[model samples]
Target: MTGKLYGVSVGPGDPELITLKGLKAIQSADVVAFPAGKNGKPGMAESIAQTYLQPHQEKLPLELPYVQDPDALTTAWAVATDQLYEHLSRDRRVVFISEGDVSFYSTFTYLMLTLRARDTAIEIQTIPGVCSPLAAAAELGLPLTIWAEKLAVLPLLHNLAELETALDWAETVVLMKVNRYYPQVWQILRSRQLLQNSSVVVRATSNQQKIYADLTNLADLSLSYFSVLIVRRSQQWFNSS
Candidate 1:
């Protein structure tokens, strides 16, 4: 019999944020695979799930390049898929851990695609966890969406014009991977006089978590790679009490 694959979301930053089912999968899996960050650094997913990892489980860190090129991404996913396939071929249960939810802007998505493409009959399961945007909102006591309000969760914005267009009509916008383009985003929000409505959370729910309730005047500030920016068109909904 072939082994099953589990995409376990370890949640954003906080180790305790992992779901019960996710922990069980991690503890019971024969092999645990996580993305190996730049320069062979341990991936965040593995770090978050380290406490639950059993001594008998094999750990596999698959190299994943941090780039936007489709070819590079495909190659990286192929490599990871093959590594996971090695364990599966031996009838060993494999669980690929991921940060945040596996379906949202996660590297596991690409790996899952490649694995399924290789064999459509492969058994795959996803265990959902709390995503960053919601974590940031909860930390700030802000409502992401309410009533008929619209919300947009965008990946790192490269073009200010495109970002302006995307958030112009939406009631709320959650900008993931904001550290790279934060200066530009600050200028855009300032130009639109929406700076006061913007808030930032760095490494939300983690020990290093930092919150910026108002970034109206913060200039040229450097942030960590795990930062997220949330912008509200109107501040009428935030319950700061």
Candidate 2:
């Protein structure tokens, strides 16, 4: 009997944000695995779940590099899948913890896909947790969307035209992983006079979390990889607060 694989979302940053079911899965698992951090530091998922993990549980760090190279990604996923299969073949329950929701831009999705492709008999389950957009909204004390408000969540901006299109249609726009394209984004928002209605939240819910409610003078602000930018077409809600 092959052991089951649990892809648990540990929330954005705060350990307490983890759901009861997710916490239970982590504590009961025979092995706990998370993405390896950069420069030998603990990854965001590991940092959030560390306090709840048991000493007896084997910790595994799977290397899932941040890159756009298809071949490099495929190789890394294959190696990580094999590593998990080794323990799963012996019937050891393995829990792979992700920083945010396992379904939303998560590495766990790739890992799960690779595992299923490798072995059709593998059992897998995913537990949902807080994603960055929701966490950022909470930190900003604003509603992500109101009734009938159209919302668009975009990844890194590869083209400014896409941003223009989103702003034209969506009442609310969320830009994830906006660190690199922040200067460009700032310029666009500035041109459209949306700076006052825009906000930036970095490392939401973490100890080092930073919040910029008014983007009026943040054109040159440098942000980290975990930054999120929220642009609202209406400043009514923001101005009232």
lDDT comparing candidate 2 with the true structure:
0.93
Model 2 worst lDDT window (10 residues): 232-241
Best by lDDT: 2
Q: Give the CA lDDT, 0 to 100, for residue 211 in model 2.
A: 98
lDDT (tens digit, per residue) of candidate 2 on 15-64:
99999999999999999999999998999999989899998999999999
User: Cα RMSD (Å) per model?
Assistant: 1.6, 1.3
lDDT of 1 by residue, 29-145 (tens): 999999876655667887788888889889999988888899998888898899999888888899999988888888888888898899898899999999999999999888888
Top candidate (TM-score): 2
Q: How does each model score on lDDT?
A: 0.88, 0.93
lDDT of 2 at 202: 94
Clashes of each: 0, 0
Runs with alpha carbons beyond 4 Å of true place in candidate 2: 237-241
